[model samples]
Every structure is written in C-alpha cells, then in structure tokens.
Target: MTAMRSPFRDALTTALLLTAAVAIVAAIGTQLSGGTQRIIIDAMIKMIIVLGMYIFVGNSGLLSFGHIGFLGLGAYTAAWLTIPPSIKASLMPGLPDFLATAALHPLPAALAGGAAASLAALLVGIPLTRLAGVAASIGTFAMLVVFYAIFSNWTSVTGGQGSLYGLPVFTSLPVAAGFTVATILGAAMYQASASGFRLRGSREDAVAAQASGIDIRRERLIAFVISAFFVGVAGALYAHFLQVVVAREFYLKLTFITVAMLVIGGMRSLSGAVAGTAFVAFLSEVLRQAERGIDLGVVSIGGRLGLQEVGLAIAMLIVLIFRPRGITGGRELTLGWRSR
Candidate 1:
C-alpha cells in the first residue's frame, strides 16, 4: 500500500533535497582555499536571501525590488546591537540611549535585526500592499530608494557611505550552511501552508480570489513580514560574515543579482530559488576566477576587466530567451517515488 501524499510530505522532500545539496557543498568547501570558501559563503548567503524572496515573490506572484531595503535595515540594526559601545560611540554617537549603550550577543542581535526588518515591512506594506501591478512594483522600488537615501545620508547612524567595521566574524561555512538549511525548511513550510496557497490563488486571479473572500492585502502583508524576517536574518549573517556593513552593499547591484537569481531559477518554486542561487553563484565564482586569470598550460583565459558583469548579463539573457520560466521551469523538485 502507498502512503497518502500531503503538503508536509512534499515540503519535507524538497527541504531535505535542498539541505543535502548545501551540506555537500559545505563539506567540499571546507577543503578548498579561503577564497573559495568565501565564494561558498557568498553563495549560501544568496540562498538565504533568495529563499526569503521566494516566500514573497513566489507565492504572491509579485515582484519586489525594494526588499533589499529591509535587508539594509536588518544589517544596520544588528550592527547597532552587536558593535562594542566604544566603537558604536565613535561611529554613531547619535544612537539612542539604549542602542548606544547596549551591546548584545550575536543571537540576540540577529533576532533584533529580524524584528526590526519585520516591523519596517509591516509599516511599509500597509500602504504599498494596497497597490497592485506596476504601481505596486514602483511603490516598492520607491521604498528602496528611500532606504538608500536615508542610509546614505544618515551619517550619525549608518556612517553615511563609509564602511562600518569591528563586527565579529562568526559566520563560518558550517554556520551558513545551517542557516541555509533552516531557511529552506522555513520556505518550504510556508509555501505548503494554506496561506501560501491562498496568496498564490489570489496571484492567479485577484478578482476570483476576492470573490472567494480572500483578503489579498492581508495575505500579501503577511508574506511581506515573514519574508522580511528571514531577509533581515540574512543581513545579520552577512554583517557577521563580512565583519562590516555598508549601505551600498544592500543597494542596486546586490538587488539586481538577487532578483536575477530568482528569475533565472524559476521564481515560482522553492527548488528554483535554491538552484538559481547555486547556478549564479557558481557562474559568478568562475567568472571572478577567470577575471584573475585561468591558466590552461598552453593559453590563459581572463585577466580581463569588466568580464564578470558582461558574462553574467549574457548568461541571464540566454536563459531568459531559451528558458524564460528559469532553469527549473517553475516546478518543484520531487522524488519519483513520492506522490505528487
């Protein structure tokens, strides 16, 4: 007799596959050079961020260009909580009394950062979520611009354009892999939940969903907050991973790469998010290595400037042209023996 298929079963299968793949990569990355390990960390971080994105964009069928703003908020909030009081005083003397004096552990700081981003999302989503289609996308983009402008000029708090340093480097490959696994599980559970299904239904047809009594705004806002919490956690991890924070790191270039990852991986599925992240990460690492010079005894490739961006853009264009739904074609990964 065959066991009955359920959302939990499907989620478990997908989560296990994603976790296993990342764990394997982590094990292999441990044997590689420091530079290569850094690449792996970068990839895992992108996985976290993209999965957070999948929670929102994948289920809602909405494109958000401003989620990076939440990422920045989380990073800075975590930085404020974790940096030493003395360093904080020097860099951001204008911090509130509590923030200026309170130096917390990484775990607390990460939690606080996630909470901060979720709060920001709630406030922003209230109005932005009310809009739909291009207008909604523009509203979110505007929010990102607002975040950038504020962080860029808020020298007393954000250090303006300067890099904020002295953060503890605690995000090892294993640590990142652990987070990636958790993120994968969380994304899968959410995607299989009733809320996720309703949001997707609304995405399919707003009018029909509304006629069915589904509150689109509420669903979108819920997703927005949940996604922000994870993205914010990714930011905290990123801050500790790099031991630095800069407003610019959460800006346009980062946004483009992350969004591209989602689009290329198949924004509709959790597997797509993971695959896209790994694919783009591998391509990016190779391109960067080539830019440094890849020697092949007889001849060498790379040592060229600006090739990484050019290569990535070309690859993305090719994928879009040929596989517009992305590498996974918007389908979830499943074991052949498992029930669909």
Candidate 2:
C-alpha cells in the first residue's frame, strides 16, 4: 500500500514545483523581445485570474461567469487610487474629494483593489451562494452584467465608458511572476485547508456534506470572497501593465476566455488551471500572429481576422470531445514518488 502524504506537504510540493516553472518562463521572457515579454506577463495575469476562479468553481462545483466583474472593480479601484491627482481631477471631475486628490503607489492600490472586489463578492454572495447549479451560475452572470452597467454609466466613480489612463506601468515580467507565484502558493494552501475539503465535499454530495455539519452556503461564500480577492489583484496588475482601464475590456469577451481557460484546463484542479491558461495563451498568441499573416518560403499564409477566436473555439471543442475532464483530468501535478 502507498502511504498518503499530509495536505501541507502536498500543497508545499505543488507550490514549489509551480513556482519553479513560472520562474523559468519569466526568466526566458526577459530575454525575449518586448512583444513576447508582454505575452508572458499577460499569461501570468490570466493564470492568477484562472486560479482565483478555480478556488470557487473547483471546490464548490459552482460556475461563476461574473468573477471578471471583480477584476473590473479591482482595475477601476486601482485607477482611482493610483492616477495622479491632477489627472484624476481633470479626467474624472465627478470624483469625490479624496479619490480626486489621492495618488497612492501601485502596491497599496493593488491591495485596495483586492479588498474592494472581496467586499463586493461578500455582498453579492450573501444571496447568490444560496443558489445551486445553473441558477447560481446565472446569478453570477447577472452580477457581471450589473457591474458592467454600473461601470459603464457611473461617470463620477468609474469614468463611465471612457478609458481611464495614466496608471504607472509597473507590471513587468518580474512583478507579474512574483504575483503569479504568490497566487499559486495561496491557491494550493487554500485547496489543502479544511474549508477546501468541506467545500469539495459539498461539491461532490451536497446532502451528505450538509448532513455531516458543513454549512454549504457559508463555505461557498468563503470561497467566493477569496476567489474575488485573487482575481481583483490580477485586475490591478492588468491595469498597471496596460496603464489603462476600460469597462468593455472586462465584459463578455474576457469573461468567456477566462472561464474557457479554467474549463479546458480542468476546473477541478489548480494544476489544471495553470496548464489551461498556459496552453490557451500560447495558442492564442500563435493564432494572433497568423492573423497578422505569416510568410513562408514558398507560399504565404495568414491574414485571417478572428482566427484567434475561431481557433480557440475549435480547440475547446476538441478538448471537450477527447478530454472532457480537462487536460489534467482534475489531478494536480505531483512528484512520481507520491501515491494517491
């Protein structure tokens, strides 16, 4: 018989391995051209977002189409806190006294962004967590729509539909990699915790979990808030990276892509989350290059607009057909020495 490892040991091993892998990628990115580096940084940010979604969807078997809304909230919050006072005053004159005059650093702004998202998640999760299955999923989508509408129309706070710029560009390869490692560790630890177990139990069998004294709603709520915070932080990083915040960017397209990454990688496992994000990001980048037209020695091919989206759709369909459980099959990446 194989011996079972402690949760802490398992989590630590997984975190260490993932961190090393990310570090290697980041290192390579530093030597690449500017465009490639941007792709790597963007992928790292997406990893954070996917991992955040995994915290809730993986453990609770709940699908949330609205988590990207938290990302938007985080981005806007960061913009509000970090944009220069003069810029804020002119660009968003409807701002309150404090936000108009405030110009905090990116680090603190990122934290505040996460806090804002978490608070919003808590407020929405109160009623949302009570729902189950498709209902819960739909509820979350509604939440996203509501956030999009508010951000698009609330000129005073969110600058309405206009893009909010002037954020310091602080999210480089190192910065994104650092946050990605932290997110990986946080996700692994959370998955190995008691709450994670309870949540998973409920996911597998809600009645049995409730009978065993698990408060389903509370567990879901906890995961929801924690997940929001992570995605929110990713949002802040994204804002700093692009130095701009746009409500449309956080809407349907992003929501679909991020959720697809989680699903294609296996939403049930953290390893799957990372794997899926990396796979899709690489594939998307390749398709983007193709869309711009690739030149070969004999024949030239490319210049296909919407190739990225179409390619992603086809890839997702293929994965669903052959590997419905995702590339990882809902399993964590582990050393061969361990036995399940």
Candidate 3:
C-alpha cells in the first residue's frame, strides 16, 4: 500500500515549510533584538539536533542515548580549528602532529569537525551495531559516558570543564536559518534514499533484513555516520551561538533533552522531528519563563526554585501519559496552509 497522507500531515508540513520560509526572510530583514534573535537562533540550532535524531532514530529505529557525543566531538573539533593558532599552541600542547602543524578556516573547520565526528561514529558503530536490542542501547550510553569522560579529562584539546571561549561569532540568524533549511532538506533526502529503506527494514526486523542480503552492521554504521555528521554541524552552531564550548553542554542531560524531542515527536518520522523539536523547544521555554516568573510589578515569587526540574518532569509525564507514540507519530510535513 502507498504511504497514507492525512490532513493533519499535510497541515504540519505546510506550517513548517512556511516557517522555514519566514525565518529565511526575517534573517535577511532588518536586524532583530538580541533576545528575539536568540530565540530563532536557538530554534535553528535545535533543528540540527532534531534532524540528526530523525536520521538514525527515524530511519533505523535505533534509540541512541549518547548522540550528544557527536555534538561534543563537533564542538571540540571546531574549537581546535577555529581558535587562533597561537592560542591553540598554548592551550593544547602535545596535540596531534597534524593539528599542531595545520591551521583551519571556519567553514573548513566546521566541515572537518563534522567529518571527524562521522568518522568517529563509523569506528564506534562497527562494534556497537553487532549488539541488538538493549545491548546496543547500553553500549551507546557507555560510549557517551566515555566520550564525556574524555572531553572532561582531555584538557588541552577540549579545554575541560572551563569553556572554550574566543570563537569569532560568525553564526548569524540568516546563517543559522540557512543551516536549518539545509538540515530539513538533508533529512528529507535521507528518509527517501534506498539506504534509508534498507536501514528501516533492518530496524523493523534485523534478522529478516539480514536474510534478505542486508548487512545490518553496514547499514547501522551508515546511519550513525550521517546522524553524527549533522549533530556535529549542530555543535558548530552551538559553540558559536553561545560564544563558547564546554563539556557539560554535550553530556547525558543534553542527550535526554534531545531524546525527549525524538520520543515525544515520534521515533521514525521526519515530521516528528519538526513536531517534537517545535513543541518541546517551545514548551521548555515556556516552562522556563514560568519558573522564572513574569514581572507583575506588584509581587513576584518562586525565585528560590528553578522551574526547569519540575517542568522537565511534567513534560515527561504529559508525553508518556497522553500521547505515548509521540505528537507526530511518524508523520511527514506536507501542505496545510494556515494564514495568520
């Protein structure tokens, strides 16, 4: 049977398409306030993370608990490349012979970081893919922990707990929006590719897919690399976006937030990526604002407690209780035009 397209799907797709367009135009429009600009920028960065999720989790039905490692890898890679060569020598002594010898441009550095992350994922994916079910899950989690440990301990390269600062902030709203567009198109293309189909097949039933001549390990690795690459890109943006890079930024907690986006949006769906990211991203902000408490002028309370903890718990509860399959439930963004 052909893939069914519901009205809801059409509407969701159209809305996101319009949003991408509007964001692009706005990016080119007159400069926006810093806070407003930051919101859009944050959304765009999150777009990359969500798209990465859509690739591996969506196509292959794999749940990676440590995908943030790619973000860490990308951030560190970019930091090393983009940082002033003089700064590098002082910060990262006894580094890779090539790194010490070579200097990098921002664009090239971003590409290199993405490539490095994908390569790293490839190496790691080989052995990890051999395990099935929860074994794979735990293996990946361990991988994340290991990566975090390395980042924390590898002072010279990553700068350890201290933030990697002094990155020239080249990431503007327009650039971020462009990246978001690219991310959407890339994820869409991956979803429709032959390899994607094979990966999905393996995801649905690895044994059956193997019987049909599919190399599950190869397929998983491919997905892992692709996902890692995008996540790496997201890391580049995040480093520049915050004007710094830190190990904690890509820890298990970041993984949890990203996983929440995938799970609440619906695993194995492109539309779900957008849906989950939009809803979760926006909701998180709202909860944060609520926790912070709006200024009434008359009085203000709840200063001692940050709403983030409670907000996160509530968000998790809402998703698990009401919409278990996630908000999108594996849908696609199509044509549902709504005028404001």
Candidate 4:
C-alpha cells in the first residue's frame, strides 16, 4: 500500500474543524446583538493570536512570554499606516513624516504590521533562540518588558499609555473570521511541513537534531519569524476592531490570557490551540456575563467585579492540576480513525 496519509489528513481535518468553529461563532454573532458580535470578534482575535503562538512555541517546544511584544509592534505599525493622516498628525505628531502623512487600506496595514513584527522577530530570534530551556523563556519575557516600556513611555509615537483612537473600524465578523481561518491554515501547514518536523526533532532532543545536521537555531528562528507575523496580523485586526490602539491592551494582561488559552488547550498540537482558545474564550464570555449579574428567573444576582479574572485563574489551575496535557491531551484532530 502507498504511504499512509494520516498526518496530512489529520492536519487538514484539524484546520477545517478550527475554521468551522470560527464560522459558527461568526454566524451566531450575526444573529445576536452588536455587543455580542463584538465579543465574538474579540474571541476570534484571541484565537488568531493563540494559534500564532502555537506555530512557534508548540513546534519548537519553547515557552514564549514575549510574543505579545510582537502584538504591540503590529498594533502600532497598523495604527501608523492605517489611521487617517489628520488624526495621526494630531495624535501622533511624533510619527515620521512619511507615516504621518500615509493612510492605507486594511490589507496593506495588516501586511505592514506582519512585516514589522516578522522583522523584529528575526532580530530577536537570533540571540534568543540560541538559549535553551527556561533561559530562552526568560529572554523572551525580557523582550516583552522592553516592548511594553517603549510603548508605554514613547508619548509621541505610542500615545504614552493614552489610547490612540480613530483607527478605521474595519474588522467586522467576516474579516475576523477570515483572519482566523487563514491563521489556522497557515499554522497547520507549517506544523505538518518538513521544517516543522525538523524543529520538533530539535525540540525533542537538540543535541541529536544538531548531530543530524539540523541547524536548531535556524529552524527555531524560522518558526519564530512566522509566528510573529501571524500574531502581528491579529494585532492589526484588533486595532481596527476596537478602533483604537493602547499600549496596555497589548501588554501583560493579554499575554497572560493568550498563554493560558494555549496551555489549557494543549501546546503540542494545532487542535489544542483551537480548542483552548474556544474553551477559554467561551468561559471568559460566560464569566463576564456572570460578573455583570445573570438574572435567574426568580432572582437577579449582583455583579462581581473581579470574577472574570478570578474564574480564569481558578480554571487554569484546575486544568493544570488535572489535565496538564490540556483539553486535547496534545492530540491532533483527525477525520478518519487514527490508530494509537
């Protein structure tokens, strides 16, 4: 018989299922109120970011606390390119003459964001990917801190913690859904490709992979740049979705949530990325509603301001304790039977 197509088949199934879930969310959002649709967009954006993280962290077996820095990079680049020149001149006068005067469509803005993030990743990955284990993770975390500081304090360029508003609201449910699907397909393809295989081999045993002629750093850096670009796309989408760009929005808070989603979903497989994002996003929405007080026919419960964070923390802890492999147990989704 010909070589079995299990892996590729499984990857396609996983991508399709992931796309299906996003489509369902988009459909449901269209049927619901505007606020609900906004929530769906937010969730899909998170899905894209988490999937982007998986493209590197999952394949390379590296924990990155710094991809959110790429998110900030993408967000700011999109703001610079896409925001109206008049608004840019008034709010971000520190922007370069070219950027301040340039206004672009959403596609170009997103591409610019991705390119900027990928460039940053290329520079950082050279040094960072050289390290291994916890050291690499810490280095990435430091990167995030550096980005946060710059964006927070760069008054002219980033609005200095003030929200940069008037971004053209271009990310509707369809746009968000399309981005999510593209991210899923891109990640799945990379995961099943030769580079992904070599990277995973390096991840499992760097010494062996190195002995086998695989340049560990090169592979890791490739994944890093690719992942950064995808996350940057998510950031651009987010900027347009909210019609604003704020430093704090792309900082630690979001970093924590995206990381949690990945961990709870399973960092080993693409399906885990999708499952984790959907699970956490749905849970988050529920907790948000609960915090705002859900009305049970007979009684109106008062809102609990911090419940969302508290619930997330508790859920993460429980999942870590019970299912450290995540909801998908690090397994890829498959269309046909997948023999153990």
Q: Which candidate is the best by lDDT?
A: 2
Q: Name model 4 segments beyond 4 Å from true.
A: 4-6, 337-340
Q: In candidate 2, which residue ranges exceed 4 Å CA deviation?
A: 1-5, 337-340
Clashing residue pairs in candidate 4, if any? none
lDDT of 1: 0.89
TM-score of 3: 0.88
lDDT of 2 by residue, 268-327 (tens): 888899999999999999998999998997988859899988998998899999999898
What C-alpha RMSD separates each model from the true structure?
2.0, 1.7, 4.1, 1.6
Better of 2 and 4 by lDDT: 2
Ranking by lDDT: 2, 4, 1, 3
> Clashes per prediction?
0, 0, 3, 0
On lDDT, the stronger of 2 and 3 is 2
Ranking by TM-score: 2, 4, 1, 3
Sum up the clashes in candidate 4. 0
The digit string of per-residue lDDT tens for model 4 on 1-340 reads 1344755666788788778877887887899998888888898999999999999999999999999999989999999998888888878889989999988998889989999999999998999988999999999999999999999999998898898887887999999999999999999889878899899999889889999999999999999999999999998998998888889887788998999999999999888898898899999989988989989899999999988788889989999999998888888777652421
Residue pairs with backbone atoms closer than 3 Å in model 3 (clashes): 13-333, 13-334, 58-268
Residues 5-105, model 3: lDDT tens digits: 33334434644674676475555543767887788678778878888867887777778887889888988888877877677677777578677656566
